[model samples]
Target: MEGTPDEFGAYRLLAGSVVPRPIAWVSTRSPDGVDNLAPYSFFNVVAYDPPVVMFAPVGVGDDLKDSPRNAIETEEFVVNVVTRDLAEAMNETSATLPHGESEFDHAGLDRAESVAVDPPRVAAAKVAFECELYETLEVGTSTMVLGEVVYAHVADETTTDGKLDVEKLDAVGRLSGSLYATTRERFALERPD
Candidate 1:
């Protein structure tokens, strides 16, 4: 089914069927040192050899989002994993805040220092990635920002036997519209030998 769609129609279709997209709760620091936080569903890890992660910030007509703008300016940002417990606070930071306003303070989310980046990580998140912006690609009306992972922090309690315990992390996912989902119940399948 080959079809051409206007921006709105294409976006709606893509957002609707990208089931259970992982939410990247990004924290970025402005050049003036103010912190901003927001969640983006158009995010995923693209490669492992160089540890590349991609996130798309869709422009509102022609304006770029604050997070991507900050990343472009500073070349660093932190991606925090959203858990069920922090879903409400994560959603709060999604509100449109004035430039220079700290989303950490506005949303009441705690901030923690990163090991390899200037931007701070969300303190309550079970997992956090401190990344350095590798490149910014202008695709149509969206900006796809690629990041090189510089450091990763995983809560000790959430790690078990050298693996991240998904159940213990209680990660939250984004759904269409204003809906969210929790990874409370999951089934595993092993690949055939």
Candidate 2:
């Protein structure tokens, strides 16, 4: 762990230590009108005041990923949360299809039109954020795209008195290689103010 590990080694270390990572099922429409859907485990919310989220999509042999490319070209994308029930569909969408291929069709997933963005979202997602491209930072081989969420959708059943219920959400997380986890475990820690 002291030496500068190779790219793959570094990724393995991080991916293993990260434990459970939330999945960002991103949807974007290419300029040619092809709909693309992919899941990025390197994703998280960066800010709340302006409602910003970021996802790092590593290049495929120095080639730009379709998600970042479409976001850059159209300046819009949708982040759909993956529920446990939709795990298979979410995983299916991650297949590396050729450019201009529609993952919505490839994965047999339904597309729901976004309100404020041109890209569509997964019809079954409990939560979806319609975001506008805020900035892109080239972080090594991966490109970090920041998006400013403009419109948000949340299923009524997933909330209790306006607060998210983790049990109701039943989201899945990525764990190392092909492993995945559910949010069924519970623990709590109060922040020391």
Give the clash count for each candidate: 0, 0
Candidate 1 lDDT, tens digit per residue, 124-189? 999999999999898888999889998999998898897888778898888889988888988999
lDDT of 2 at 81: 96
Model 2 per-residue lDDT tens digits across residues 1-193: 2766564498898999897999999999999998999999999999999999999999733487888899988999999999899899988888888777888999899999899999999998999999999999988888899999999999999999998777789989999999999999888999999
What TM-score would you give candidate 1 relative to the actual structure?
A: 0.92
What do the candidate models score in CA lDDT, each in turn?
0.89, 0.91
Q: Which one is best on TM-score?
A: 2
Alpha-carbon runs more than 4 Å astray in model 1: 1-8, 60-62
Model 2 misplacement above 4 A: 1-3, 60-62
Best by lDDT: 2
Cα shift from native, residue 29, model 2 (Å): 0.5
TM-score of each: 0.92, 0.93
Candidate 1 clashing pairs, residues 3+ apart or interchain: none
